[model samples]
Target: LLGRFFEARAKGRASQAITRLLELGAKQARLLRQGTQVMVDPLELVPGDTVIILPGEKIPADGVIDAGATSIDQSMLTGESHAVDRGPGDEVYAGTVNQQGRLEVKVTGVGPNTALARIARLVEEAQATKAPVQGLADRISAVFVPVVIVISLGVLATWWIATGDFADSLSNAVAVLIIACPCALGLATPTAIMVGSGRGAELGVLFKGADVFERAKEIDTVVFDKTGTLTRGAMTLTGLDSEADERLFLARVASLEAGSEHPVGKAVALGAEERDIELAPVAGFQAWRGLGATGIVDGVEVAAGRARFMADRGLHIPDRYLEALETFERRGHTAFLAGWGGEVRGTLAVADTMRESAPAAVAELRRIGIETAMITGDSRQTAEVIAAQAGIATVLAEVLPEGKATELARLDAAGRSVAFVGDGINDAPALAAADLGMAVGSGTDVAKEAGDVVLMSGDPMSAVVALRLARATFRTIKENLFWAFAYNTAAIPLAALGFLDPMIAAGAMAISSLSVVTNSLRLRRFH
Candidate 1:
């Protein structure tokens, strides 16, 4: 009976030890994984191949949509819940998803500069790029392990040489080494960054890495891209003539523009769809690119294009409608008037309108004391119009595609920490040049690759949320630094004076690192 009891006790101890070993292995594995290691190889992706994506699956790389129209749920890359419709020529980001459609996309970016590659680069860069000032914790950790080793050796040697206490010295040395781990110090940064990045991802904000997070905290000025950044980027039918049976005129115009690829044509078609109008097929179809289209509708030669198109046809477009057209054009709208047999019938106003959230987002930034500015290729009048609507005080209009980088440099030279928010092919150079570059959802992969942070919602308003998260993260870093530095300052002197044992110093080091990690974990609770 005694033998059986002893055997059972031994088995229990063995099981407990095995469990502990497994747990320790898991912890180490997790630490290694979070240690800023790159896992995916760039060469794994093939160029010019069709990348297939199913519903709810993240796009593994950057690609151009080759076929199929689907509602993409890009909330993982863009914070909005509205499933955006995508077709051929549209670029999809690496981490976005096909919400309800199966898209066969042609891989465009295959190597390090691909959207996914950019994401990886951003994350690594953020981690490697430390804040301007080192945290107190990291400085302490720098000297911590070495000092602990020296003091432990001295304690062991002094005890054995002075009192011949070999066992006592060993015990004291082991205790000191065991307790003085810099686990808290190490945890401080990775934990906070992981938490912040993860939370931002959930909210549709992708922080490339730590540097962006750190720099974002210090941003005093925000520059916006006009078209897709602040606006809906979709043309809408703002107004129409109701006095002349505008329904028939709109339907006739829609029929004329049915095959045209101009943005204004598409907007007219969408407006007609909303009104549930069935447009009759038109004949003698002709397109005047950059102007409009014309056709024979209901036996009448109906032409829908710029006011000049009507005037050229000898149609006397009334001064009243012309004035309205001028006003809409000044506000960044494209005006189209419809006419039959050279007599002006009606006018349709179309414009890419600003988002409902834009003005409110600007107000929120103002509330936080961040100055807002606008940068665009739009004419001065149009830029001023949008600026006024959004309550922005500074406006830089008529900026060409390549001019954005120069503007960013100018701002940098002026000593302002500028953050640029934009979407589109033209915004790539500026996105790369800004102190902090933000890419909105649905932009080109190149733009996403160039940005420090990608806003999945594609809404500029999310920039405000990002700024808040960054500030909070910076504060956590400061706290951790203080704890790390203070521990070394107090414990090192005590150890040198022979008052503090090696075991105590080790314990202090461990506590500092652990505390940093715990503080970082707290960021997970931030909304």
Candidate 2:
């Protein structure tokens, strides 16, 4: 009975963490009905309902803001430390607090469809699953139970023949059986896993399964995807030079790029918009994958992309333009050349800022004796610069999107256990190929699904936290198992030798299980 109590207590503590997260859903929602506010249960909300959120109220459901603006505190959900500004057309998740301004949010998701609910479900499922170490304990316990019974029968017979006292012999046999109950062995691995994973969730890390804890501890090399993983993934136009009228050159390039869905193209278009440069309509816009784009901009033929694209188009590149391209590349900025009417007209440089946490994350990984590498589709000079900035020594530059998985395979072949961190649809393959895949929370659904661990904080430093937590959790499991095995080994013989009374042996068995539970609960204090 005492053993069962300890198990129940451990389970209760683990569930408490998850319960607190699920409670984020507001009980009542203030909805805008016919321009008047009506209070209703959050479950009654549906898509397209306009919910009014005032200062300090929890957002009732996931939705887009229809009117008004406010600073939303998402620290509880995403673990971001600062509140973010949200205005019309921006997304506000359910359970986040609205500060200062009133927001009219059009509901897009409700009930179980909310991000908070999904996170709770994921954590619950991970806890319910068993780790490989738990399976080993179960197998050992299965073999141990019958062997202990046989030994108990042997002790009963030996004592009866020697002393010829049935009552004394029975007590000794019963004591052996009581002390070798296997309760501690059963609770050892699972309790620790439950607490560790629960603590991980609070730190903005989510393990997809109990088994991921085992796999993560074995990772020796961590490969990070460059764009969204290390850098902010937002591009800015840093420099623009032109031989023709600067505004006209930018207008032409930005107009052709406006049709592109690429990040670089979007950056160019946004630069034009920020400068209030009116874009001319383009006819026959064609995008050459990984090279450049071409179109007829305001009746003039315009080609904008890499210098290689210019060379391919039979366009003349001036010496000054070549010098500018080299300077931009040397400075770790992506440079693009623009030309029209068979002559290179201008050059543009775009750069992405590195995340503030990236360097610290690399340093932490190194401190823990793990190797770090970076993989990117950028040019060699660009990748090297970014890698150096993050203090990463190994760089796999110019790797195509399809080649990421192959690069990870090479690391695996070299006997290195690799964990890949990424946040894009293109990274899904690599995320699956690594020994352990960690997906940033802000990544695409496909990438998250393929990853074994999801970093809900979307901070590179969280990856380091995940790894350290895994090692700590696994170490606790080992400790619990050792204590359970050692306690059984030492106590069984003492009970069989008539050195312990049956009541004393039962008390010892309960203490052994309680010790394991207490040890596992220590993980709750883990940071």
Candidate 3:
């Protein structure tokens, strides 16, 4: 019963982060009725019901926007600290906040169907799926009892013959069996694993299986996904270039982007708004994937996209403008060419800033002798700049989203055990494919499903903390096993001799268990 209590306590502590997540969920929501909005419980909502999402309010359900535009702070779900802009037709998730502007959302998911709910379910499943550590004690236990029986028989026959006393011979053999009960050996590995798992939970690092404690030490390389892993993943307009009237050029581009939903488009629109430029109304807005948007703004056909996208439209890009584009890209900014009337006007640049803790985190991994590399869908120049900022020297750039797992496999084929860290829908495959997949940040359900470890915080420094903790915990496990086995091996022979008694052997057995438990508790003090 005491052992069961200890095991239950540790398992409960290991799920603290998941409990904290559940607390953040809103219990009610404001719903849009036939002609007015009413406050109601979240359970009352159903698919197709329209919900009114005001500024500074949590979205009650996952659905597409019916009207209005606002920035939704999805940091808790996506681990993206930035507020993402959502307009009509854009999807809004339950548990995310509408930072600005009034929005009417058509509910597509509610109650158990929400992304937040799914994430909670994933956390529960992760805890349930965890298997106990298979240690040296279990293997020994299988044969130790049988071998002890044989030894006890041999001791009884020898003692009976030597002394010709039946009572003394039987008493000596009983003492030997009692002293080698393997009580401490049974307690050793489990106590340490429980405490270590709980300690990991306290640090917002969840160990899904006992195998992680064993496998983490073998990791030789750590692969990080660029967008949400190293960088803030919130793209903001940083630099812009124009041959004439820079503000006017920006206003023209922003007008066309007003109808678009791409991150780059939203960043451009936001940049123009900051300059207080009134967006010129646009018509016939056409958005092409991999290219940019083309629309009629202020009676002129204006265009914005990659350099190749501009060229395809028969636009003449100036040599100076081309040079400026290279300059922005070389600096790790995604640049676009804006044009009108067959002439390139200027360039717009946006960049995802590096997280402040990225540098220290990368350095820590390197100091510990783990090679770090970044795999990203971003262009090579952009990947290089961000990698340098994060102090990562090895960069695998221009890899498509689907190709991330392939890169991890390539590294594995080279005889390197890798740990991949990422937070994004597209990163799901790579997260599962890695030897040790760490789902960084808020731990979205999809990413969590594939990850071996889930980081509750968005800070990259937590990765360093996790690796160090794994090594420390595994060390404790080994220490406990050693003391347990050594104590049993030496005591059994002394108990078999006529010099030792049963009472003293029983006391020693209890003391050995107490020592193992006390040593395992030391992990709770780990940072």
Superposed Cα RMSD, model 1: 12.0
- Could you tell me the TM-score of candidate 3? 0.73
Report how far residue 456 has shifted in candidate 1, in Å.
0.9
CA-only RMSD, every prediction: 12.0, 2.4, 6.1
lDDT of 2 by residue, 1-527 (tens): 66667877887797677788778768889999998999999999999999999999999898999999999988777767789899999988888899879899999989888877777778878888999999899999999999999999999999999999999999999999999999999898878888988888788788889999999999999999988789888898999878799898899999999999877899999999999999989899998766789999999989998787799899999989988987887888888899899999988988998999999999999999999999987778878888999999999987767789999999999999999999735578999999999988751131236689998767899899999999999999999999999999999999989999899998899889989988988888887
Q: Tens-digit lDDT track for model 3 on 1-527?
A: 44454445555654554466556666778887887878899889999999888898888888899999998887666554667778999877887889999998999988778766766565455444333454457778779988988888888999999999988898888888777777677766666666676566556666676667677867889999887678877778988888779888888889998888766888889888888989988899998754678999999999998777899999999998888888998988977889899999998888887888899999999999999999876667887888888888899986766788899999999999999998734478898889998887443343335577777666787777778877877787778778878987888888777656777877777677777777877887887
Of candidates 2 and 1, the better by lDDT: 2
Worst 10 residues of 3 by lDDT: 441-450
Which pairs clash inside model 2?
Answer: none
Q: What is the lDDT of residue 422 in candidate 1?
A: 86
As a TM-score, model 2 comes out at 0.93
Off by over 4 Å in 1: 1-77, 81-180, 237-326, 329-349, 443-448, 493-508
Those runs of model 3 whose alpha carbons end farther than 4 Å from true positions after fitting are 1-136, 242-262, 272-318, 337-346, 443-449
lDDT string, candidate 1, 260-292, tens digits = 765567888889999999888889999864455
Q: Is candidate 2 or 3 superior in lDDT?
A: 2
Q: Which of 1 and 3 is ahead in lDDT?
A: 3
Number of clashing residue pairs in every model? 26, 0, 0
